[model samples]
Target: MKANNKRDVNVSKFDTATKTIHVFVALCDNQYQGIVPVPKTIGNGQDPDNNLYWGCANGIRSYFKKSKEWKLLKTQKLDKIRMERLVFKHVSKNYYLVADAYDGQYIKKTTTDFLYSAAGLLKDTIKINKTTIGINGNAKMVAYIGHDGLMDFQLNENFSNADGKQRDAIILACISKKYFAPHLSQAKANPLLWTTGLMAPEAYTLHDALSSYIAGGTADQIRTKGAMAYTKFQKCSLKASKNLLVTGY
Candidate 1:
């Protein structure tokens, strides 16, 4: 509950016609996070230049930059907790993607922020050209990508819905469905895509899922897209991938 010195953008003054997708990614840290250790070079969370979940080939930033459907619009350096931010616009859709790379040491904060967004408690906006994009609570979809910190720590506060916005949520973490179910239910957010068991939280899954979402796919279709991406990249069976990545309760 420390004071948040950061200021939220005045969303009322800007254009709110475009849809947005906000993604919160916690960098991989071998030292600070609780999990099987990764190679030191890529596991240094503070070093985003080579971090496993931020700058690596399969990471969100790099993967999205290479995607044909998304065009990188901006990159900004943030504070200590949120190390970096990147904004992208979908090529053929009126949608914006805002992604934050949280330092691995602040994974708890990232998790809290994601939950806050899902519950419509964290309202933040950004300006892109003439459009003002809602990157937090006002976003159409909120996504979390990183280690399942819920497995290591417990959250005492309830993430109840604050505005009844009913945002869609995508959690790309190990066993995310089980860990995030109760909180997501309390937040009144629709479970668009989440995991049932341990899996690699890579960018391909999210990239394809978002593609399907942009194509106006339903929740089940989005989940199927994610499963197909996982199966293709991880070399796992489509059935196993479908079982691992599921939608709904």
Candidate 2:
């Protein structure tokens, strides 16, 4: 913003793509004495949709934009990598888990093929792809990450709306969520239908549903994360024959 409390702001991720928060840095202004920046929401519009980003009376926009600190806060930055790649790619592929840095997590692999996919998922992060899940675990505890679809959360947004054959695919997504909620008794813990895609309903109270879920987390100790919190696995690793993996949408 300029000195007279006026500044032009473009409201789009691309608009601010170059903007990054550095550790131990801050952007401060006088109007709103000690303003804290609220991270903008990630969009869920299918190729082209957006919620409005307007200014608040007390220069809410100006203050938050100007105020920043050196270190990023916990919960400060939400939605890192996702889970679709985990369930569809590795587990569905029968691959093993290798490390991934972009998501600051891991991918999967076991044999050479599985190893290679995991390698691609983390090609930039690691050199040699050597990893596998040595410890046996229950499939019930496994979680799959899906790409963001909350904007289309309404039941009307069906498979054909997706980029693929999508009939079975869309049904599977809805079924998966419904399945996990009851099976794991985690209807409450489900991450937003999309990850880091929207703000809490603007006027809701803390006791409102979002607050509760955010506080305790969605009930499972070993809950599955579908969109943001889930793991990235490939399906083919499981089959002796190669197959296509449709990561969740």
Evaluated with TM-score, which candidate comes out highest? Answer: 1
Residues 36-108 of candidate 1: C-alpha lDDT, one tens digit per residue: 9999999999988798888999999999999999999999998988999999999989999999999999999
| Per-residue lDDT over 1-249 for candidate 2, one digit per residue giving the tens place of the 0 to 100 score | 111122212111121111111110011111211222333321221100121111221111222223221111111221242211111112122322221111211111111111111111111111112321211110111222222122223222111111111011111122333332222121112122211222221111111221223234442211222211121222223221111111223
- Ten contiguous residues minimizing lDDT sum, candidate 1: 1-10
- TM-scores, all candidates, are 0.95, 0.17
Each model's lDDT comes to 0.90, 0.18
lDDT score at residue 38, model 2, on the 0-100 scale: 38
Task: Look at candidate 1 and give me any clashing residue pairs.
Answer: none
- Full-model lDDT, candidate 2: 0.18
**Candidate 2 lowest-lDDT run of ten:** 162-171
- lDDT (Cα, 0-100) at 99 in candidate 2: 15
Clashes of 1: 0
